[model samples]
Target: MAGRFFSVFSRSLNQPFRSRLQGLMNYGLSCCVNALLQSFSATWELVDLLDRWNPVDKYKESVPLQLRKVLLAMQSDQSQPAPHQDFLHCLDRNYIRLHVQQDAVEVFLSILNLIQQQMSDKALAQEIQSLYKVTVETYLQCLECTYIESGTSFLLSLPMHIKESHNSLEDCIRLFFELQELRDRDNCYCERCGEKKPSKQRFRNSRGYTRKLHCKVTFPETLNISEILTAEALSQSYVQSDSQYSLCAVIVHSGDAMFGHYTAYVRHKKDQSWYYADDSNVRQVSWEEVQNTYGGSEREGTAYMLLYRRTPEGKQQEWSSG
Candidate 1:
């Protein structure tokens, strides 16, 4: 029966078998292509509407009217075509665009606030943190853009410079101390005069030693070396001291550099003013031998390597974990 039916149907078509098969395939492909085109047209229309819609006025007024028009157009009458889906899609696109613009505005305001230090001034270091927060939010907005990965990473890294700037300064100071050369000379004092002339004392730490003679008991306003020659002189004076090298490292928690606490290492030498130790020529010696022997005992800690640098204004501060 099936064979007979196929014979009759084939005769009725009045076309070759391959031609009929090709015709069916072409019809199916056309349907698929048409569906794809319709969907794309719908999406493009939505994008166009979002691009033109004004959230503050035009769009707000048009949305309700558009929805009502779409519903009314869906009447049983065959003459008018209803665009219910397109109207809804347009509404959603407008909302998403508005949200994106709002986020961008918020991020821009935050950047300005940081410039003004409104996050709270130097009395507390909250400003750095607030600025960092603003930076992160900006990065999130970029994630919604086209060039996501690199753009986001670049923005995120901008705030990280605050940490790097602090770290670089500490490293430079440590290097200077490690390469500092101190001048040593003997002192003769009159014991008879309770006008007792003060003896020279050398204080050694990571950088070099401070020599305080009877004449001057305080640090100089600036480091005594000239920039160009200082490096060379420091190279000649680089002595590996067994005295524990004191360095400063900033502690950052939750993307914030904690400036409230500080750590320092101190060393004491016989010549209290400033002079090099005898066996300071080797690199990486035991902690006890080169450790800043004077002040570390006063502070409580598991004793880690310390890095120190002058503050921004070149002021010397005795940083306490306090």
Candidate 2:
């Protein structure tokens, strides 16, 4: 019966049997990686960049190399059931353990970091890193003498702390940029004053563009930076144009922080349609159904990591039903 079905299916060229969405088999406890792979698949730019890499002989077990292979196979029309097993094994050889629960955010960052460390092409390596790099300035201001010390740093992902009560993504982001007063035991040693003094620790300047929110924060399907930016942030040198971002992918956790399963809802780039991908099972979904992930109730999944893409100015955002 299976052979007859394949024969008939192959013969119907006019009605081609092409799958719009493909699934990856769950090997051991690999749902987390599977979810990430769906998001990575949605990001075609990353895939194209990875395709250009030509690594030397030393780094054969490179994560990016195996990842490129797996992504290509997953997108192909092959008959293989488990195309990602070898990629999973490669990650295991790199010390990302199999059969163990993993944090989606940490694993995602680890994969990018591995690409940075293992890729032989230095120029292409930095290009991949710049895709998600967020630059910010940290400053320490002394209260007694009005002295300030500042430094700049970059983050691959912005980690925001969530409140126990209801929280919005914009509020969480605004609070992350807010200045905090440090007093008493938290005072810093002043160089000119030569003693411990009260001060303020705050982010001075930030080049906020595309960002990843790492918390149980509820964000809208479309996010505008017009309201989220504070007066101080607006006055900074890096703040240029207010950009609008659309939610492209979400990494969801079903259980508690300690034990959970990972899945993803990724929006297609060409069609702008939503698709839910659980390990080895992929299905088309609606925008309203995607909203069901907004946490605040029981038995529903919370968003662990969010992926947003900046919408180009003057272009209409088209979201069509699949």
Candidate 3:
């Protein structure tokens, strides 16, 4: 019951990471997909899931097939490089067109959906989906009749909103679950009373544009979101499970919406060493260096998506800039 859910998207102590990560060549403005692949490489859990499954159809145009091959090829000891050309081509055929500045989250979700749709093994495909699922319950109350309706919902990722001023990750998460009251023009039709009435949505839940926020948002290397869990979500949980999340990988963006560069700071699965992957260049980086992505200006690289590993273990980060 450890709400051990991975979100789309934490500090380590002193440890020098020198493991050289294989870099992907930017084939036809493939930086966006390259960054995502780097992040996925760090997700050894996902790699293992795909490894356990045997694809019935090995079509070149199939996304999951290409992805499985690429992921396995990445871990190969063979000196031959694991070019993602076929994977990219498969993606292009799937309408994730080549040579376009793609949004990382959208691409990430699309990949997940494609796996579910295209994979022959339905059980294994669902196993992959359960790895990143977030469970929540919503409560809606009508003001006029005092009628109430509640339902459970699932989410794959959480999007954080940045303000013009200071921001904190904890505050952002709390705000996402904060109850909202709808009044005035915004009213819900109550089924019991058959009248439009003000309502309160208790429980709950970025776009684009080239405009960048210069706000300084503070995010932690280790996070525990159990405190923000709604009473309903918490009630269903009979076991007191650990919900601490450790920082694993972060996708950083630098530039406007039209023209931006994507890079990833990923933690090695075997060694827990941090490495930075930028297209064809791969270099070891420290935890502090990863924190630099917290942007206070347009020039500073901003964290686009963060990947965390839920753990019962305390922060075991050792900091030593290599």
Candidate 4:
């Protein structure tokens, strides 16, 4: 529950479970998880990787197993009650309590880490990880000692700061990789001088986080982050990696800090159309309608989290149901 981490941990505020989540054997009263489930079902790549995992022994309390099951159930003929009743048991074992407000981004990260840590097949798990992995190189330089240490790391969800009034997703992503001077509380330790000192920091590549800002953020249905990758990140790739991404899911948080609701705009993999999933109720929607979540006030919803898929250059997106 996002506050991994979106700042609105109170987004759930222990709210009532919304709509028995597809009116099936829903997972206790967690609309947050319900919304997340919708997004997960939309991610065909994740489903593909999870489906490939064949473990020698299956653990009863495994989150990935339960996730795989629930995702599969979600795709079954909607006429029958989906087998999500056991979802409650899985959450209980993992201590992912219900009836609580959780941040979407935070939950997203937690689930990703759970897959990484709990998967029985490490190789397949890494394949799942690579789908959302955002690799970056961090350069840290201490001002006083002029000692510099650089290392490569990766973020499952790149956190970016948004503007108060207006924002463009690209600009925010650019700023995420920009240089920053750390001082005072943010100062770093100087290895040579054996003391703390102000340091300059920069990231080679990255992206943003949500802070419940009631502002307008403009984004595209298909996103190309190639231009936004920092000079260092681009150099490292240097025409090797494709930078195009397709928006697959959007987790929307409606209402304000005290209380809220969670919904999702998912682009169906096979159907190739947007659909608004509100627990038990799901309806077709347009890209323009999806943009309504770009927040202008606390009363309305804003995109709390997003899921994008990397698309290879010059290739048509995977549109088949297989």
Q: Rate the local accuracy (lDDT) of all candidates.
A: 0.23, 0.72, 0.74, 0.70
C-alpha TM-score for every candidate: 0.14, 0.85, 0.86, 0.84
lDDT ranking of the models:
3, 2, 4, 1
lDDT of 4 by residue, 1-322 (tens): 1111000011243765322113243444566787788877766667777778786657877888988888877766444445665665676677776766777777777888888889979999898878777777778888887888887887888776776778888887777777788888777887887888888887432236533568888777776767676556454644644677778788898877556788888776655778787766767788999999878877778898877777777888766544
Model 2: residue 289 alpha-carbon error in angstroms: 1.6
- Tens digits of per-residue lDDT for model 1 on 114-233? 323321233222422232231111111121121211121112112111111123322333342332222333222333432223232211233334221111111111232233123422
Clashes of each: 26, 0, 15, 9
Residue ranges of candidate 4 with Cα displaced over 4 Å: 1-27, 144-147, 203-211, 230-235, 238-240
Model 2 whole-model lDDT (C-alpha atoms): 0.72
lDDT of candidate 2 over 139-234, digit per residue (tens): 788999989887788888787656667788898778777788788878988878889899887643344453333234467877776667766654
Cα deviation of 238, candidate 4, in Å: 5.2
Residue 10 lDDT in model 1?
A: 20
Please report how far candidate 1 places residue 241 from its true position, in Å.
Answer: 28
Using lDDT as the yardstick, the better of models 1 and 2 is 2
